[model samples]
Target: MLILKKLSMAMYMDQEDINIKFEKMGKIRTALVGYGSVGEKMHAPLITVCPDLELVAVVERRQEKSKEKYPEVSIFRSLEALLEADAADLIVIVTPNEFHFSQAKMALEAGKHVVVDKPVTIHSREAKELKQIAEEKGLVLSVFQNRRWDGDIRTIQKILAEGLLGRVVHFESHFDRFRPGLADNWREQDVPGNGITYDLGTHLIDQAVMLFGRPDWVYAEIFKQRTGAVADDFFDITLMFGSIKARLTASVLSKAPMPKFLVLGEKGSYIKYGLDVQEKAFKAGELPEGANWGLEDAQAWGELHLEHTSMTYETERGDYRIFYKNIADAISQKHTLRVPIDQAITVLEIIEAAFLSHQEGKRIPFKK
Candidate 1:
């Protein structure tokens, strides 16, 4: 372990080495809805950084909380008022899951591009309806599956792309936390889309589908593990894609350190610990600027194990800005949506299947 750790202590690469030239076709007036933790911390900062996106407005019902950080943005009491004022060309819904469908539907009908936080909607049917509306109205629609930009995930993608793992047969991912006490947040309440399944499950399942396409079947055991928690806090979902099996797990009561990702193949395997660093930076209220943005420490890189040897693998720089950048480009017709609404709907369906599987104690088959 000492030798590997010492060998892994290579210099971090220059940020410019991975940076891309952002092309802006046209500036999009973006409005952020729900100035909650995700909206203020993640969505707003990402929107303000993209060269082709302009942060023009925010929607907060009780207070103008967004104004403290983004004073230039117009504050409205509701999505309806924001629409009435015609304040933005793009609508980003970061409200709770229940509001995603209605708000996204309203924005699409208003002829505005829409971006919703993950899960897209509480139900897959609602997501499908939103997709149809976006198609019919000629609007850009995407979900905030921003974890696709996570450094660890980027590393995994590169490893698979290079065939370093050679015909991977098994994959496992964990998003664990140690929050024994429940909070007053909506996620902890007995509300629609109020569980780890809808939260982290959306990200894990989206990443799975993004890499392996829709699974052939799903088996899961999802339940609330906390003592006083009314919402679910633990989930172990298995997504089966023919020869490959992907296992995803998340829990709020977990304390023991677990591998963030573990993969096995015929030739080798990869084991990575620690989560991405971008969220920490964002929560610290750092802007997604400068050359060294999204780069992780060298000591935190994943490890690759072959038949005879093993070494640390450099992680790809994570950039959540890519999401909004693609959104802007799609709106400009310069590029396609990376997190398309269709894929998000599939994730919802998978989540639905997982819940059903948990209830029935059987693997749920996918619709062909």
Candidate 2:
């Protein structure tokens, strides 16, 4: 057992050596379980160019359709088959909400690194179990909370770092959209982790927790705004950290949406509109890199309101590639991951508390 462990550790070369080896290797072996919207649009294309990662085989039930879409890459029908084939070093789960835990558990148990699309799991307990499993198995477990790398969010983080908004007292985040007529996908179904709070809310919540540490108390109200929707369509979340407060909201039925971000402090306030364009560009098959990748349209620039005067600040460019780059660095070089496991666990805890608070009609205290 010790010899096998040493061999695995040895295979994980230093970051620089890994980069050199990757250049020589040409591709890092990888597989996608679900070829749905996220997998086909985001992960697959990004992996195609990532120097340290490669697309080997995909796991799908329909062999013919998987082959039709990706003729060069082999297709396995199940996780068991994929594991036995020695096809990949890493497995990415973009499956339905309820399947994330099981799929990730299977991957880690099989001695392969794993990555799951956001919300980590339906409940905090599930996330905790997965964390324990990953630790015991000595594997890399990561969540695809891509919004952390959003260009505008990064810019806001930089502003905060620079103390532009002196002594932040209140902040707001919105992810409004026009999806009233719910899609036919599983996201719209009534299931564990199938609401806006779990869907888009995860991004806002994760960003809030990322910017500010875990809150002492979380006050949230979730409801369905769409006429006939089974799951929630709107959420108003407030995270309290002593005297400061972070407000987050998202609704699918809004027509005239407001700024994506609003931050206020003793010195000044900053307001930003328009989502990042990287996803749109990514979907359109464009990866020029270091160009205008994350640039916000000038007309949609944010406004900065000083207590004494008002000024408009052009939104900084946004980038999503950094997430993958950092993951590769952590895996190959043993560097600290951009978003550590503890933070992911915190996000889940907040989510669990929010659900409990909503059910009992009161603010829930976060346990240390």
Best model number under TM-score: 1
| TM-score of candidate 1 against the unseen true structure | 0.92
Each model's C-alpha lDDT?
0.90, 0.82
Candidate 1 global lDDT: 0.90
Q: Which residue pairs collide in model 2, if any?
A: 28-54, 151-318, 294-318
Per-candidate clash tally? 0, 3
lDDT of 1 at 35: 89
- Give the per-residue Cα lDDT of candidate 2 at 76: 87
Stretches of candidate 1 exceeding 4 Å from the true structure: 1-26
Model 2, 31-113: lDDT tens per residue? 99988767887887777667777788888776445456567888888888999888998898888879998888888889988
- Scored by lDDT, the top model is 1
- Position 207, candidate 1: lDDT: 91
Per-residue lDDT tens digits for candidate 1, residues 43-108, read 988998898888999999999888898889999999999999999999999999888999999999
